[model samples]
Target: MDNKTFSLQTDLALYCRTGLYEPQTSIQEHTFHYRRLVYNVIKDTLRRAFPMTRKLIGKRRWKKMVMHFFEYHKCQTPQVWKLPQEFSDYYQQVNFPFKKKFSFLVTLLQYEWLEIEVFMMEDLPIDEFSIEKKSQEDRIIPNPEIKILSTEYPVHLKNGKEITEEDKGQYFVSVHRDFYTKQIQFNDLSYPFVEIILKANEGCFSRKDFIELLAKYDSDREKIMKLYQDFEQFALQNTIFLGYQI
Candidate 1:
């Protein structure tokens, strides 16, 4: 496209996104209608993506926040569904009045966005591994689509408005899609379990490896064994460990 055509399109997009810089033409009235339609589409998409956030922030402030994001934040994603991820990123970085009051907002955005991410994630290639091999000596393979989120607030358990000073503590959550069912699942975990999953994500780990790793932290054999057993059950039940590598 020519410079003038490109410039015109850019201006229209800005107007649609921010309701600013209306093109000086006879079609200005039509452009206003088009802009409203564009804004509503984005608003609806965001509303669905973050229903809990909207409820906590209230309608008036949420609308203002959306307008602020629309006007100032230059969204990069062409996909409507993925736009919330960008918004989440933007919210975390930008300083907002609500952020001070709602300290857990960023974590909440991440928690909610993860559900969409896990559900829409592409199928991981597990052809090399065999689920039939379940042995302590064999290295366990984790689902490639899994994600672990560590936050200061228990956004997974409570809404933004519901959280208090008592709720401010370390929270670890594992969000993953079920390998067979294709359903998204969330699991609350302790710090040690999070560490184990992080290690597993780095590479395959066998039950023996986890036991040795735990031994480095604690010399008590019984404690290490119990912790390993708990993690083993959690991993297998959630499909965090898809299977043992062949």
Candidate 2:
């Protein structure tokens, strides 16, 4: 397309998003109708993406927030489903009016967006390895489609309105898509366990490595060994650890 046509299209998009531009008298009526349609599409898509956030903030406030995002933020992703992630990013960087009232808003947005992310993420290749043959020396294999989130608010446990000052503390959560079921799952994790999963992601850790890591928190060798065993059992049950890598 020519530069003038491209520029016109770009201006139209900005006008639609911000409701600040007036087109030529000849096309004003059609432009108004098209802008309304565009706004509705964006509003509806964001509403579905952040249902929990909307519930916590009320409809009127949610509408205003959506408008703020539409007007001020230039979204990077073309995919409709990925827009929520962009919105979350925008929420963190921009100073929204409701931010003071809802300090945990960004964390809540992240928590909600991650569920969609895990649900829509593409599948990863699974290597042929037997759980029965797993050994301490074997490097662990973590589920590829997983995310670890750390938040000061228990956004994972409590809704935004329900969260209070008392509930503000360090919290770790593992969000993963089950390998066989393709279902998204959330697991609350302690600090040490969170560390183990993070380290495992860097490069799969062996059982011995897991023990030594846990030993840092507790000096009891026997207790550390037992904890590692328990972790292995839990990881296998939840598909957190897919299997031992060959």
Candidate 3:
């Protein structure tokens, strides 16, 4: 907080971020050496966080953004788990021209980062029930690691190099850490299925109940059976159902 401390920090930060610092004659060449080290560490961290975004933005612009982040964004959290989120937070308020040209960059970075985030999440146990539920009061608890995302760009599948405005669409997806394999998993989901999962987490609807609830609009048995089958396919994934509550 004092003038001397602030001046020292400001010089280091500027050198690391933009290579624009007054040469400290006291430290001599040692200052430049440390500056390079600091810059590379932060640059590598950003690269690891946003791999796809980095490739899309290319080397020049990606470095620039990272520098911008290093210069303007003061990271308060000491935990490394939060740095990527902080990087994304910096861009949330500042809409620069690159965003207009590459509208999918932020979404791509978010989607790419989510895989590692879920993989590192604390595991929650799920009870496996291979058979149909018999009671109306039984509840379905969604897997604690499951993250449901609705995005304008399909960042997971796309190559991230050639996305234009025409490639945009609403996508419903679920990403979870597999209970058995301990691997990150991804799946496509419909809006209805998402709604079912949300309501199930509240202990309101079982799969059978959801299908039957839809049956009210149309009494078609074939359609109801199809819906039931679809729900089964999704439920086959071990992470989808966290286990039923009595």
Tell how far residue 48 is off in model 3, in angstroms: 2.0
lDDT of 2 by residue, 88-180 (tens): 898898877778898888898999999999999887776665676445698888877889999999988876788988898999999999987
Number of clashes in every candidate structure? 0, 0, 0
Flag clash pairs in model 2. Answer: none
Cα displacement (angstroms), candidate 3, residue 199, comes to 2.1
Off by over 4 Å in 1: 24-29
Q: How do the predictions measure up, each by TM-score?
A: 0.90, 0.91, 0.77
Better by lDDT, candidate 2 or 1: 2
Model 1: per-residue Cα lDDT over 46-142, one tens digit each: 9999999999989987998888888788778888889889889989778877788887888888999999998998876763677676566888888
Quote the lDDT for 228 in model 1.
93
Cα error, residue 142 of model 1, in Å, equals: 0.9
CA lDDT for candidate 1: 0.84
Clashing pairs in 3: none
What stretches of model 2 exceed 4 Å from their correct place?
24-29
Error of 3 at 137 (Å): 7.9
